[model samples]
Target: MEDNVKELIEITALVIEVIGILVLVFGTFLAMGRYAFKLQGEDIRSFQKIREEIGRSILLGLEILIAADIIATVVYDAQMEQILKLGLIILIRTFLSFTLEIEIEGKLPWKQEKHRTTGKK
Candidate 1:
C-alpha cells in the first residue's frame, strides 16, 4: 500500500508537470503574438519592455514546470542519478529565473535605459 501511494503521487506530479509544460507553451505563443502582431505601441522601446515582461512570465512558468519534473523524477526513482538530474534542472531554472527577474524588474547592473534608447548597445 505504501508503494502504491508513492506511485500515485509520482503520477500526479507527472501530470502536473505536463500541464505546466502546456501552460509554458501557451504563454510563449501569447508573448510571440504580442511582438509579431505589434499589439502594443508605435514606440519600439515600449514594445521591447512589454516583450521582456512576457518573456519573463514564460520563464517563470518554465521554472515551475522544471520543479514539477524534478519532484516527479525523485518520487518515481530516488536514486543518485535522479537526484543529480533534479539538481541540475533546478540550478539552470534558478539562473533563468534570476536573470529574467533582474531584467523584468529593471534592476539591471548597467544603465539599461540608455541601452533601450540606443537599441541593444
Candidate 2:
C-alpha cells in the first residue's frame, strides 16, 4: 500500500473504533439517565425498553468496531495469523451481537412477526 493511503486507512480505522466506543458509552448513559428519570414519576415497566435500547447500542457498536478491525487488518497486515485473529474476533463479536439481539427482542430476527409491518406470518 502507498504510504499516504496506509496512513489514511489507519486513521480512518482509529476514528471508527473511537466512534464505536463512544456509541456504547453514550448509549449506556442515555438509557440509564432515561430510566432514572422515569423512576421519579413514570412507569417502572419501561425497564424493558431501556434494556433493549442499551443492547441495541451495544450491537451497533460491536458492528462498527468490526468494520474498523476489517479496515485495519486489510491495510496493516496480511499474515495468516493476523487473518485468523481477525476472523476469531469477528466470530466472537457476532456471537455477542446475536445473543444481545435475542435478549432484546425475545425472538430471532426471522421469527419476529410482530416486529414486521405487513403482519405476515
Best model per lDDT: 2
Question: For residues 1-121, could you state the per-residue lDDT of candidate 1 as single tens digits?
Answer: 9888878878888787778777777777777777777775675675675667576666768777776876676465668886887778878887777788776766864644556575775
TM-score of each: 0.68, 0.85
lDDT by residue (tens digit), candidate 2, 30-108: 8889788875234447877788879989999999999998889858567889888889998999999999989988889
lDDT of each: 0.73, 0.87
| Least accurate 10 contiguous residues by lDDT in model 2 | 38-47
Query: Could you give the C-alpha RMSD of every candidate to the true structure, in order shown?
Result: 7.1, 2.7
TM-score (C-alpha) between model 2 and the true structure: 0.85
Q: What residue runs in model 2 are displaced by over 4 Å at the alpha carbon? A: 39-44, 114-121
Output candidate 2 Cα RMSD.
2.7
Q: Any runs in candidate 1 off by more than 4 Å, and if so which? A: 41-47, 73-78, 108-121
